[model samples]
Target: MPSLTHMALVELEKAGILKFVISQNVNGLHLRSIYQGRLAELHGHSFMETCPSCGIEYFCDFEVETIGLKETSRRCSDEKCGARLRDTVFDWEDALPPKEMDPAEKHCKQADIVLCLGTRFQA
Candidate 1:
């Protein structure tokens, strides 16, 4: 269900025009579009969960039932560390995660052109 804009981004990445993507979208559409290059999901992806202990991420096929970094019904898959898995999405008051933000900042500093779509700058 990738949109034409998403497909175009993928092609741009393939053609080496687009380097990295910094997305505020929680729907996980960029990954679905097959853009396998660098990405930083600032708000968090609804289909993703992460282990608080091991920092391993699990990308689910369906939307997670919880947000606000709440614990899901599953545990981490790593045999040595089966910590509780928490949804990646954030609530209104939650601060943006540094794991996603740091790389995004780094990319933004390095990029010559930053193309933003469907979002507004809040100052």
Candidate 2:
């Protein structure tokens, strides 16, 4: 279940107070909260799997079985594309996916105020 904070973010987005959300969280709570606004999951989402061939993303009800972009048991829904789906979560050695990174960078640059929540900064 999504936390109260996640719910609040959704409300804020609905009111247009929150333009975009850049999250490092892989738990997919933001998505589960039904936030239909622009979101960039920089570290990938636990419940999301993507097709390599068709570039289609599937958001699952359950947490994906694997991380590090490994293939999952499911295949793409498109009749023409039956490629295996891969988990979106990143391993330690994995590079940041450009699909999420590019928009995150753009949003950061364009924003006047950036509110970061629940993040730990190490010195």
Candidate 3:
């Protein structure tokens, strides 16, 4: 699902020219674009979840059915912990996850130049 531009950035990330990606897009195209980590989804992803109890990450092949950090029908499959899984999407009132924000802030501060791609922001 990665566009050509996204793939080009993937190459930059591989060459170490790009350090990290902070994305608000929830389409999961970046994840599919040979993204070998070093990224954050500020708005959460439709195909990813993290277990609160065991801290396990699950990436699904299909789009998760719900959004807004709501409980999904699935549960963690771990033998030790089978806690119900929650959707990763943030509702309008939801705050960005610190786990993603902290590293994004750190990387941005350390960068000499930043290349922001197709995105929109409001003051």
Candidate 4:
């Protein structure tokens, strides 16, 4: 999402209609441009890439070109491994992060209204 979507989410949160937004995106647009500590970005934020080995999430303040296209995907900033972090959001094989799931569950359990937008479910 972009700045507009981020603001809408923030407003929804303030209205208490939404506890958090679990995005299947790694853009980090919300985490960087919008309010922090209020979102549960499931796919991980782009501002920092975590090392699967060391579990170290490094913050890179350097400016990366926001090309707004597929070319935006690049290798991690760490020169050591230079591993290209996956930006396709949460992989099909990957499971949900505990930190993200907790809040989602809490919201679902307590929310008087469950709004499923544009979801396609199979019976």
Candidate 5:
């Protein structure tokens, strides 16, 4: 992703031109790093960490390794912490994160212009 593109999009959102971002990507770049408001990850994000024991969801500030897995898989570097970073919408055995879903729905319902670009809707 281009930094200029990110800056441009952020500016658009801040200026109330683009209200929401619904993405099939799990990179976490758009939401976690770039646009901080009104985002819905239809896929999920790599920067979010989940606790398997407590189901605690939090934005992480750790690096990840994606050298071997599929293009989407990401894990936190804190082995002692034992929290795994999820890039997908979570496992079928798991549940959806409200932090990501609630605002997405709200944006969808409120936004006047809905733009779909380069999206393949399988869901």
Candidate 6:
């Protein structure tokens, strides 16, 4: 599912050169990529929603409309607990999602090499 460049990264990981990927992109491209399992979405995903009551992630094919961690129009599929599903897309006002942040922080500390895509990320 990865593009040529992303597949190149997958190759690195396959070779044990790339340990982890920390991404702030909401495009959901990474999720569709072959390296999806090895990456994290730091800013939440435009096509994902999470159940607050039960920690389950729903990855949808369609792009979620709302930002700022607002509740989406859908409900959790779990019948016993039909909780409102919150869109994972985050805004500047919200804090970084912990599910993504914790691993990113851990990898940043452990990795000997860090690649900055563009903007400088201050720890």
* List of clashing residue pairs for candidate 5: none
Give per-residue CA lDDT, model 4, range 1-123, as digits (tens): 366766776678778676655565666766754466656666555556454433445555643333221223456566676654432245546787787878777766776876554336332
- Model 1, 1-123: lDDT tens digits are 778888998899889898888888899998887554488888899999999999999999999999999999999999999999999998989999897889889999999999988788675
Error of 6 at 103 (Å): 1.5
Model 4: residues >4 Å from true position, as ranges?
Answer: 1-3, 51-55, 61-89, 116-123
lDDT of 5 at 80: 62
lDDT leaderboard ranking: 1, 2, 3, 6, 5, 4
Q: Best lDDT goes to which candidate?
A: 1
In the range 5-122, model 3's lDDT, one tens digit per residue, is: 8988888977879888888888788888746468888899999886878888899998999999888898899988999998888988999899889988998899999887886565
Report the lDDT tens digits of candidate 6 across residue range 1-123: 456866776678778898888888787776665356568788888988989888689988888878888888999989888999998888987888787888888888998998786457776
Instruction: Choose 4 or 6, whichever is better by lDDT.
Output: 6
- lDDT of every predicted structure (CA atoms): 0.89, 0.88, 0.85, 0.57, 0.59, 0.81
Q: Of 3 and 4, which scores higher on lDDT?
A: 3
Q: At residue 77, what lDDT does model 2 achieve?
A: 93
Residue pairs that clash (backbone atoms under 3 angstroms), model 1: none
lDDT of 2 by residue, 19-120 (tens): 888888999887776554488888898989999999998988899999999999999999999999999999989998898889889998999898888888
TM-score of 6: 0.85
Q: Please report the candidate that would top TM-score against the real structure.
A: 3
Number of backbone collisions per candidate: 0, 0, 0, 0, 0, 0
Q: Which has the better lDDT: candidate 4, or candidate 5?
A: 5
Clashes of 5: 0
Provide the TM-score for each candidate, comma-separated.
0.88, 0.88, 0.89, 0.55, 0.57, 0.85
